[model samples]
Target: MGYSRGIGIVGLGVISRAYLETLVGHADVRIVAVADLDAERARAVAETVPGARALSVSELLADPEVDTVLNLTIPAAHAEIAHGAISHGKNVYGEKPLTAVLDDARAVMASAAAAWVHVGCAPDTVLGTGVQTARAAIDAGHIGRPIAATAAFFSAGHESWHPNPHFYYLPGGGPLFDMGPYYLSALVHMLGPIVTVQGAGSRTRSVRTIGSGPREGETLDVEVATHVTGVLTHASGALSTVTFSFDAHASEAKPIEVHGEAGSLSVPDPNYFDGDVRISRGDGWELVPVSAGYEHGSRGVGLLDFAVGDAPARRASGELALHTLEVMTLLLESAETGERRRVSTAPERPEPVPLTTEAEWRRIADA
Candidate 1:
C-alpha cells in the first residue's frame, strides 16, 4: 500500500467544498489535481491546497499520478465522469444517487467491473458515529430483533437558500431523490437491505421562486414530486416507513427512529457525520455512548476510506449507492404506478465500521 493515495477531483461545485475541507490536509490522501466546467473555478480551488494542480477534466482523468477520481459533479454527470475515470484506470468515488438514471447506473457499474476498478458514492454519512453507533447497538443486541424503522426528512424547498436551486426541481432532482439517499442508507445500516417498496408522492406547485442569491426572484419549473411517503420491506422481514419532502417548512419528528423487539433507537441525521444516538427501553430515552464508527468524521471520509484500501472501500461502495438509488427511484415508480414494487437489486449490507478515533485512523494512515 502507498503512503499517500493520489487523487484528482472533478466538478468543483458547492459540495466539493465540504470534501476539500475534510481531505485537504489529511495524511491518507494527496489531492493531485482538480477540474471543473468553469476552469477558473477549479483553478481557484486548487490554489488553496498545497501541491494540488488545476487541470482540465480530461487531463485530470488521464493523469497517471491520479490513483482515484473524486467526482463531485451534478447527478446527470455522475456516470459519465465515473466511467471516464474507470476507463483511465483510476478508481472513482462520487456523490450520491450514483447516477441520475438507473440504466446509467447499471452501465457505470458494468463498466467499472469490466475495467476491474472501484466505484464508490456518497451518503457515507452512514459510516459516521451517529449511524454507526446505531448499527452497533442493533448488532450488540441492544435493540433485539429489529421490527420497524421510520425515516423522516421534511423541509422547505431549497430555493429558499440555494443559488442554483433549479436542479432540485428537475427530473433527477426532487424531494425524494435529493434527500432520500441519506434516509435510506441509514435504514439499511440499522436494519438490512430493502426487498420491496410501496409509495405515494405529490407535487405542491408548478413552479418555485428562488428566495436568495442574485437570482432571488427567478422561478424554476417543478418537474418532479415534492412530497414522497413510502414503506420499505427489508430482507430481514422488517418494514421501514419513509417520509421525505421539500414541500413543508418544519417537522417535529426525529430524522430517523428504529424500533426493535427490546428498544427503539433515535438515529441522528444521516446527512451529518456525528450526533447523539438515543435509545428507549420503556423507562425513557437515554443516550447510547458513541460506541462505534469514525469520530469527528466529515464529508470526504468516504473518499478517505477509498484511499486507504486497495479495492473500493465497502464503507462507501458503489453497490451500496446502487441499492440506495434503487430503493429511492422505486419509491417514485411505485408512486407513479400506484402499486407496490419489488426491488430486484439487493446490495450486500456494507460491513460495519468499528469505532476508530479519527486520530488513530490518521496515525495508521501516516504509518
Candidate 2:
C-alpha cells in the first residue's frame, strides 16, 4: 500500500505511546522512523512498528523518507526539535505548549513560516465531540451572544502517579502551562481570541515527594506556582474566569462553562476526546446532541488532520497553538507582576470541526 505521508517520531516517553497507539498501521500515514535519546528504547519501540527503523535524532531529521517530524520531547525541547525539522525542510507536529517560553514559540512560528513548512501542535481534544459540540451550539446561537465563561481544573499533582514527575514542578511544568492549553484552547474555540488577561497565583509548597515509583518517597523542588487563577478578556468582549491548580485535592467545577445572553453551556473535560455537552436554556440543563467534531478521535488525529489538510484549513494549526501558548505564559507572568497583560498573537478561531466519524476522516485522509 502507498502511504501519503511519512512520520519520524522523536521522544519515546509515556506520551509517545498514546500517539503511537493512535497512529501506527493507519491508512493515510506511515511510521517511517523513530528516535529518542535512549537508543535501546527507540529500537524497542521501532520493533513494534512495521516499516520503521530506530535512528539517531539527527539522522531521523535528515532522512529523506521522513516528511514530518513528530516531536514528543519535553517542553524545553519543543522549539529545538521544531527548529531542526523546519531547517531540514519537514513539517512538524508536537505535544503542547509549543515551547517552554513564549519567545521560543514565536521563533518556531517564524522559522516554520520562513521554511514554508506547516507546524501543528497537540491538545487537539477540542476537535472532538465534547468541546466541538459546545462550540457548534455557540456558533449556531443556541446560546445567544456569549457574555462570560468559567473554566477550572484542579488536581493534587502528578507525583503520585507519574514515575518521573520532576518536570511538573519546573518552570514550564506548572499546572497553568502543562494543562491550561486544554481549557484555554477549548475556550478559544468556543468563544474567540483573548485580548487581555489579569492573573493571580500562589505556590502551595516548595517541595513535592514522589509517591509511587522506583524514586518513590524522593522529593523535588518546586519552582513554579502550584495554583493559578486568571481572567481573560476575549476579543468579542466576553470574559472567561479560569482557575488551574496543582495544589487542590479535588473540585466539582465543570471543566468549562460558557454563559450567553440566552443560555449556558457546560462543556466536558477538554483533555479527552468526547463527553456530554450540557446546555441550560431558561429550563434545566439538557444534553446537547453530539453535533460536531471527529468521533472516536485520539492523540494523533491532529497529525492526521494536519497531513490531509492544507495549512490554512487545518483545525489544529500552529498559529492556534502559539496563541494558546502566549495566553498561558502571559497569564503566569501576570501572576508574578500583579498586573494585567495583553495577549499579542491573535490567531483567528480555527475552523470548526463538523460531525465526522472515524471512517469518514480516514477515508478523506486516504484519498
Task: Write candidate 1's Cα lDDT for 20-124 as tens digits.
Answer: 878776777889999999999988998998889999999999999999999988898888999899999899999988999988998899999999988888887
- Please write out the lDDT profile of model 2 over residues 1-367, one tens digit for every residue: 3556999999999999888887886787889999999999999999999889999999999999999999999998999999999999999999997889889989999999999898999888889999999999999999899999999999999999999999889877899988999999999999999999999999989999999989999999999998999999999999999999999887988889999999999999999989999999989999999999999888888898897676665878789999988888888889999999999999998998889998876553322
**Model 2 misplacement above 4 A:** 1-3, 362-367
Itemize residue pairs with steric clashes in candidate 1. none
- Count clashing residue pairs in model 1: 0
311 Cα displacement, candidate 1 (Å): 4.1
**What TM-score against the true fold does each predicted structure earn?**
0.97, 0.97
Best candidate (score: lDDT): 2
**lDDT of candidate 1 vs native?**
0.88
